[model samples]
Target: MIPTKLIPRTAEASEPPLLIKSLLAQSLKYEPQREIVYRDLFRMNYVEFNQRVRRLANVLAELGVKPGDTVAVLDWDSHRYLECFFGVTSAGAILHTVNVRLSPAQILYTMNHAEDKVVLIHEDFLPILTAIKDQLTTVDKFVVLSDKVYGETAPDVLSGIADYFSGEYEALLKEASSDYDFPDFDENTWATTFYTTGTTGNPKGVYFSHRQLFMHTMGLLTYIIGYEAMPFKGSTDVYMPITPMFHVHAWGFPFLATMMSAKQVYPGRYEPELLLKLLIKEGVTLSHCVPTILNMLVSSPAAQKFRDNLSRWKVLIGGSALTKGLAQAATDLGITVMSGYGMSETAPVMAVGYLNEQEQQLPKEDQLELRTRAGRISPFIEMRLMDDEGNFVPHDGHSLGEIVARGPWLTQGYYNDPERGAELWKGGWLHTGDVASISPDYWVMIADRTKDVIKTGGEWVSSLDMENILSQVEGVAESAVIGLPDARWGERPHALIVQKPGYNLTAEAIKSGLKDQVERGELHKWYVPDRILFVPEIPKTSVGKIDKKRIRSEMKEQILTS
Candidate 1:
């Protein structure tokens, strides 16, 4: 039997499990006249919002979508994408969100892997989809979600065996049933599937069940209110999900925004300047984004304009490590910045670095430092770090090991790949394959990926430590460390550097930074990178993590051609 404690009956629980359905009901019940605003469109209230979601679901069914059928959406963050996220999942269909940033082949591969029955595509991506239509196998229909209505094509642009409809999403929803008796969906039913953009291999698809999502939604609700001894969420809080919905439900902000009745905004396409403008104009109280994105935004010339706006903004950083420099900048600007960590497979929120009971009384600077570290394990999660021998590592924040986790919201396996699924679920635990150290306080600090860990002269070196230290150097914009092939030591550390604009970086300076580490005994003399190569910029994966694979590929090409 499922623990009642696991699924608490809060005031939010009185509503239906059809999350969109409940959201619609809430808007009508508490604030019938309150605005549910989007870019260029305002959903007047729950009444109008519910009707549209219902119609969209009906239109999807009319276009041949069935329960369990995957309906892929490819678009920037927008109200249309948000509507479809709820409408598709509400209809007992799996919402497969494609990362539009991926190349044509990668996008096609993900769609085919999901066996998407219909593609509710953005009009902007039509040309690209048209180009690859010949290769897609399972797509039976194409419903082009447009802000404006358009007529049928005079000429055949796509050679796919499917009908196309270019319909205004809002109008189509007017034609759908406002009161949909949603199918009694089993909690174990698949709700969504997405591919993880792992730096090493082809993206692996991970899916979530309805029950898992329900639990995730609850966890998000708990997180927003700081239920696990976090900063209390206020009703006046304004939310801007700079993170796209395609990225783990925008880290569950969309659901929480509606549940908490906060003003919700989506940056149609993330531009740092535009984001700052919105933050200033909209008086956004909270936002979530990666450290890199924040770094770029705060460094922009226009950032000065939002100086006072920054004071009211509370930000959460994820995707990659949140460095002390970036955190200090945000803190100095009065931005309440905290680091959070999760993988795509874990519904993307295993832990948030909010103050607990003991942390609450600490001085501001002390609290800020704690906020930078991955906080204690969340209520719903159980985490452990283990070595290859299955021995548990000490939580003294010094010993590094692999992070493995299991929880209600954690994914069980990849969509169809059994071999990888077994590896991911080895020992009945979802292995993160990320090397990290946990403190006695239960704070988790990721050192580097297990595959990226460097070995030199029979000793291990942390690539993340080297990269972090390198980033502190003047004239260095970004840096990456990787284990390169070496005859004597099996693998040696290699450095890839992106110099600041108008600056020239030398290998000598990077070696100098490590020379101190060598003297201090933090690193051995031979563990330093033998060569440093400067690049135009660091390549990033779809979700914005540094793509070391691309660096290795370019280096290999340069070597072979030379």
Candidate 2:
């Protein structure tokens, strides 16, 4: 009775709904021998990778991980985490990647809130678990993942506790059967859950369905490289994820890399030296990280020593804007850098700064400027610039508005908090809480985060704009701008600067440079900060973005004392 054209019902037509497992199976066929390296210690081909993942699913079953059970992970980015992405989810259990950087109380809250039944923890975080084990209510078992063999020197904190200690990760896989019967489930089933660290209060959990995760991976694959002259070359690219796996699925690269069957390198911990060595040794061509990580890498002595090796590396910078000064510095070090944008919501990635045909043909400097924008939305995503009154704003490249989006891969709502969830999805669009200007050509240039914008005399000033200008000041290493309360103007901007070694930077010099730019019409005069503070370092959040909330509190006390 169905139309012939609509027949996914044919016997030959699998008609299977979208799911994440299909990505894993299809990628192995492309490059089965592609290697996945873990630190400087371990390496495995795609075939071996599949076997290990299957073994993990089998072992998880033996540990009594049931459907709907949350299997939490507390580890650095490694091959093991990649396996957990698939094996746990493929086994029909939700994968809860615990943010190890969270405080003991915060970590306990997320684990308890997610109601995680099993935790696959790295040896490093054993002390953290030991401290909070008494308070953990939902965690039934703890599986240790160690680089070295356990039981030889297995700390009592890990192996001695019989009630909570389940087994070692590798040992369980080796002892379990390899034949994993991954059954078909509704594609809308919950696959992964992770918490978002807002400026204050307890973290809120955001979850994604299997279909959403699968579609996000596909969207990245299609838009990033499916078009011509893109950076990554499918199976030929060497990928290393610098972003923590716990943060936004490492911005969804592990899945995309697995789907491409590309050579992957997972740095267990992010040490600047270790990362530089890996890039040179493994020939890592493509990676994604925040501005802080890239700045750390290019500013390192190792980068200067291995400048030639860095030339071949292409990095996508997100988590914050890619300032022109930072991009130029990376270029000088021979690293190709571009800005990308996303959040913990929207399955993490909705836009990347890729060049179109016309934009690509422009001058290199102009191209760099164009490419630093949070480019057009991902394919199949519906984006709009909404004004304060909820009307769509014009895309004339000057009018700024909040960037809202809707798509298949976007998270339906915040997990367990209907009130906040409703706010997130208000007006049928996922509120990004980021203000941006869109050009008629479809470029989305982010101006500022709604909360981070500085209000002076009731006029808006971008903290990022101040930071960008400060970044260009001679002898300035990094800069962060925050809005401080002022009785006269309501709020004035404050600048925090970290100086480069061997260079003496004074507040007057910075102010003078900013004044020159303002006179040249390059920047608005109101964008200038009221005060400049030279600090040894800026405080950062768990994922390495500037901790404005903490800095604001601490700096206020310092100002009062001074």
Instruction: Summarize candidate 2's per-residue lDDT along 71-114 as a digit string, tens digits.
Output: 99999999999999999998889999999998999999999999
CA RMSD, predictions in order: 4.4, 2.5
Residues 1-562, candidate 1, lDDT per residue (tens digit)? 6756556567755443444445434545565444455554344554566667777888887787888899999887876777776788878899998988889998999999999988877667888788788789988777665544434433232333244554545555767677676666566878888887775567899898777876777776776575733343535677788787888878866765665555667667778777887777666788888877887877677777668668878888888877666676677677888888898989888878867777789998788667777655666888999999888888788998899998989988887788899999999889998899988777888888888788777777888777766766777767777777778888777788877667876788778878988999987686578778888777787788777777767765765586
Q: For this target, which candidate reaches the highest lDDT against the unseen true structure? A: 2
Poorly placed runs, candidate 1 (over 4 Å): 1-24, 32-34, 40-44, 147-163, 199-202, 228-234, 357-368, 501-505, 516-528, 556-562
lDDT, candidate 2, at 207: 96
Worst 10 residues of 1 by lDDT: 152-161
Error of 2 at 451 (Å): 1.1
Q: Identify the candidate with maximal TM-score.
A: 2
CA lDDT of each prediction against the hidden true structure: 0.75, 0.87
Candidate 2: misplaced stretches above 4 Å? 1-14, 150-160, 228-230
Q: What is the TM-score of each candidate against the true structure?
A: 0.88, 0.96
Kindly report the root-mean-square deviation of model 2 from the true structure over all alpha carbons: 2.5
User: In every candidate, how many clashes are there?
Assistant: 0, 0
